[model samples]
Target: MPTSENTFHLGLTMAGAVSAGCYTSGVIDYLFEVLDLWEKAKRGNVQGIDQNLVPKHNVIIDAMGGTSAGGMTTIISTLYALKGKLKPVKKIPENPMENQNVLYDSWVHLDDNEEKTFKKIWDVDDLDGELTSLFNSKVIDAIATKALDMGGDVNDFESYVSENLPRFISKDLEILLSHTLLRGIPLSVDFKTEIARRLKNSPMHNTFEHYLVSHFKLNSGNPVNENSYLWFNPFKEKYSDKIKLSTISTGAFPIGLAYRKFDNTQFSDEYIKSVTRRVIFGDFGSENPDVNHDIELNNYPENYSSISVDGGAINNEPYREVGSILRSKFHKDENEYQNYGLIMIDPFPDNDDIERKYKEPKNLLKVVPAIIQTLWNQAKVKRKEMLEQYNHDFFKGVIYPIKHRIINGEYKGRDKNPIISASFNAFGGFLDVNFRVHDFFLGRNNARNFVQYFGCIPYDPDNGNVHPIHREWTNEMVEKFKVSRRGDERIFLPIIPDLNLLLEGKEPGDDKYNYTYKGKPKYNPSELFKLKDNIYNRFKKVLDKGFDSFGEKTEEESETPISDALIRREYRRNWFQRMGDNVKSWVVGKFKNPVKKAIASMLSKFVIKSILEDLEQMEVLDDKAN
Candidate 1:
């Protein structure tokens, strides 16, 4: 049972995306600001910062979870929170002559005379550019140089294809595969190297559990009960080297695509193939590896046979982990109005995929890659749907979903889901400092907007301090606010007075209405009528557009909700059935990943071969024409 002092449990779960992690960093930065935690955390860790370690106090999140790129974000956020440092937020100075503040307005400046400022608004910044430069120099540039030193560049394949039009048309792709294989080594090495360098001097370099203790009771100076610091990372197999490898493991693409060994025999052919097979087919020990056990590399040679890959490949969203934390921690409370809730930051919210319609294949062999790609994408969408259904069934009212706002700016480009989609083709914007600055501000502003409308319901649901948006029946707040369906965007509604009640109140002393005998419609008759009328109008509008009011559909206009009972029944297996479900899940898990792996393997092996075969046929036809 939770103590009165620590009654509430709040968890934050972040979803994965590659370069879009900067947006999540911005969201966390704003959350810290809202909680007023930076100053309090920093005051306790003056010495820790000097040693380049995270601070030891003032953490507000009870449980935190993330996967893939979100795994990197989670680690970086935890480190910065402990260190009391904000992720760099700065835009390039513009219009120097018109406004000097625009010229040199940033938390970080280019010169020694300048100082770093901690401002609430992240409009100005030079620190972000400096960090990007460091990442380029330490990681990106190093990988490019290594690729060149290997006797060829990945771009050489494109060059070869363009120069030999007849060969490309004929489907010759020998040069393509040769270039593709060279990319894996350099990228993996530099990524791991950069991650290591960032965390080299950290104090708690073991399990996440050891690192995330009760910060408020650090040295026994305070007399508070130990706070439950529940944390979940989908990157399995954490050991003493977790500090160096946790983020890398979670973000590693599968089947040795982005894997690097820190051992002397890393380059051997047999070693590489063995690790590949192990990752694709073998298990990562158990669903939850013993958190307390430290598996030493040398002693556990068998355990080291398999390597960790992208957590997104298995569990892109950490919904299950977070749900478990809530269940285990608060099951004993038994209160109808529980003081526990989860806030989810979803980078990839469900959207209708604009799938391409391919013409009938001239040859069946030519269609394998297309088929594989479709299946992979479909699997991801299906997985998200299943998770959404499960959460809706079990934790609908408690879970608050926060979708990242579309990055708005000159560089916003075509990618609406900037939290997950990397718009590589965007003009000078993505490459410019201002683009990243916009992402930081985008996440910050999104968080600000989210807090204004949604929050955990107080233990006392009625007469509690609810946001104005939720206070429809209150006398003071009734005229000021509106309530919309869960699916619709919140909009204001006009207040409709109960004329009968108003007239009855006007005649105070008259016993004509028999006030004591009749109940006054339990609050408001006109308000209920107005709400029902609004729903009918919305339903009618959808019907006129030829869309079924009862069906689920995604449109350019709005999202229509489906039947609630259907969603609830889809993924109903819960704690009561955990014993039987675990066995069933284990069996399904065995074949699920290998099926995905087989599709990926077949695509890689056959696609280039088919191209080459077609190229030869084209060459033969040219000879006959000549």
Candidate 2:
């Protein structure tokens, strides 16, 4: 509910990351906290709220779009935003040290009865008769359990025996095989069915449908003759449904490759070959694959109906959706909001590094999987290139490039765009509790840093006004700061001062006296004065409290999560490391329970001590600087 004179028409587009979406959820958790968008919605108020309200204040968002796993993020996050369930269960203290205590204490200390902080942000209650069902219910568990249970029917012992073993086999042998081969049926069909069923049952689903319908109405009458706000890339043209949007958007390979209900389409040999070529080489083939990209909604079948798959197969990063929607908004005379920006959050920035084997496949067995991987990698690379261009072109927006490691590399439009980096060890599996906890905190802390340094005011497009905690700088002011510090070499420093007197229209002279340049200077006198004043004011605002504290390390910035050591070292492990660890863990579990327990206990203590020492060392560094 934050109000701002420089309010932004924020449009968000998230990048897909399979299980790594836990990290993305953490990012959204913190963003919602800063925006203070946790107020619950009442009956009839949730739907059509964005259009009904006058163009007066920041609401939830102007447009919500993503692909594959990111599409799931859009649905889940938007659901939370609408239901007013985004606030953190634990209060974040004002004191930095106190905040650190909350973070570490929650993770390190044991609490079985109480829900973990990460689970709170990620889980929501199932909507039933209870009005507070969402408050107490855990969303991830509910959906996962239902998806697993109803996804496939349980196989009976007789059926299993008949399917896998010969009828002539001995009764005892058949029973043994049945017990060993006790697996359920294929889950893809059931999984999609479960997702649709849940959506249909929930009232929030109705609210979301209303929201989309309203957007469709607003975007329909435009002169461009295209829908502006809502989009999802289905494979074949079909009828659109609010319930199906979430399902279709998430129907990528592995998850929903056989989702053939809407189109009655089969993955024939020729169809796959053609699809692979387009996916791997892009629309124009390898020579000019990057140009004339064909995944935008504009290229969709003339009708709104279509059976879809994971949109990532076509466009992994749907940032163009933001651009397209904003353009439509800009052209619409009825649209009242002036300021606009895209908040593009990419969870899988490093996915381009997931390459296929450089050498040719050794056998026919590896060919199909290899081709699929090559296609995936090539598609990701193309979209990543497009994302880079999008960021450069839309330099007035906000960008969150979540990373697994902290680095000093300069991002595109650093001086123009409000780019905030949230780094942490995102190696934990998708449903890992420890990873979710650490990731949530990592996101929250970095969000605090964003508000402190960049001063991005969070605006909700569906809701009304909330005051901003701090002021944000305009592009002109930021450009001047870069110009004034043109010669400064320091990289880690957040703020830099003018290094040359000539830039300020002053002559370089001896220490004894100051000299003003009477001759024509490099810059206009008035411009130079304004630059100096801006730099001085920025320094006062950012660094007056303490220079050392300006860029002091937070938990995410300083060290990898403790869970990284205990659960998985990192996400980028090679096949050998993964196989070795699996074998080693199995061996230890089977033969050395005591040894495994001892190692875990010792490792936990060692990691905790190391973290404390590192934090203390940072404090000492701060003290010495002061």
Candidate 3:
């Protein structure tokens, strides 16, 4: 049985996008703030704040979910928290590089050039060498093992290839074969073993065993099972043992990474005969695993029959899962649901004109408009379906009202009403109409006195600006305005400062800042760097609170302090690793288009010729037998 904790239900879900890192960082920052506030309140340092406002550490998170890059963040955060290594929230410096260094120093302990260590391990000077070694060792070994099991030697395979496929033998073809092997078998047993070793000591091992839900796919085309979902229950020792490998398999994007396969032991007795040869695998993200649009939210069939695709197929947000879980708990009369909070960290671009574009698919070309219109309609239906899943009452009170207000001209134009007229209204009118009415109705005497004493001054219609009449008593109005402004500031309090800087159209401190790309601001490097810093700072702030500075270690601290050089080395190492992965992805992507065409053209000719040649050889063998 899985261990359960009675804690407040705090469900966190993140959206998929390049900016997911930034959004996740902001969430971590908010969590740190909550932790800080709680600690301060306990110590009686934070005035006017209740300690209960901050959730206890044990009960802080009931469930968390994410998709794509956000999924990676979710796992990392959960693991760190379980290990009791969550850092505090602190303000990052303005210098982008400095912030970058801080991030490097914190996570993945090593200097930038530390990736060179891999070179030492592999006895390779460059990435190509490393790849070549990986393919030879992992890919060739697997093939050789399989061949041996089938009662064939390496020489037998070479002889079969020589006699049956003469045209396929060439220097270029050999290299392509190696590359193909690399793609076909991306993950090695050794790599999986290493991951398992790491997880053995991980603080999150127990939580992973109990609560982690991994989405995976079984090969639909295979004879054993047409289509099946691998819903791994980590609580089971059998499943827990393969959690790390399962995570990688599910999360690996299909673009560059090959589909991972596992031996289907269920069919071993009937299908394999002597050896279990049946394998099943596919992309977990297929058909939107997060939402699974075809099925009811609560109904997870024992054998999932849908084709897997990218999680972004139905929706980028993975909050539906969290919401469903929480709703189920609520229905079960779980007390934690009463104090539940949902935090959705969305990093995707939020365009105000999205609904407008959906409604009016205007294009210069007629066909283009038609295609766009079709897509827009489809998206609208998907959105509606998603909205329907949530509680109608909660939706109306929270999300529906915002949508209605934004569309109903509430967000546009200045306040034309003759009540609570203020000079510093940037958003034109107050968002809360009831509050405006309450101010005027409750303080009618004050309003009358002000008007009678100073005289009413109407806003200029031509200028469309509110120009309040300046009077000696107007200073009081200004003071009141300032007080109101303070209340408004609270809404922006939890916003990540680095995100604010980016929104202001300023460079947030990237080392290799590109001015523009294709006539648009190219702030990718800076944005990602800031995101890394944000995540790192939050972890450092919370976990390493006793440390005087980043590199310094107190006598009481058990962990060794990292040096500046080591930080730089580790950062370089990570950069190189990322570069290698990107290059491999790009190469594989380029190979796909051309290779498909070439294979189609060649296969038509090669198949016929090879079959005839094999038949002739069989006739000669028959003559010799006679």
RMSD of each: 27.8, 25.1, 29.4
| Residue-wise C-alpha lDDT for candidate 2, range 133-215, written one tens digit per residue | 11122433333222222222323433333343221111121000000001111111123354566574432211000001112
lDDT of 3 at 244: 35
Ranking by TM-score: 1, 2, 3
- Model 3 ranges with Cα > 4 A deviation: 1-8, 36-40, 43-59, 93-242, 249-309, 331-338, 349-626
Model 3 lDDT tens row, 211-318:
122432111111122123332222233433333333233333323222333333321212111110111111122223333332211212232222222243234455
**Model 1 regions lying over 4 Å from their true place:** 1-6, 37-59, 85-241, 253-257, 261-303, 332-335, 354-366, 374-421, 425-430, 456-626
Candidate 3: deviation at residue 564, Å? 69
lDDT against true structure, model 3: 0.30
* lDDT of each candidate versus the true structure: 0.34, 0.34, 0.30
Candidate that would win on TM-score: 1
Tens-digit lDDT track for model 1 on 33-57? 5444323323442222221121121
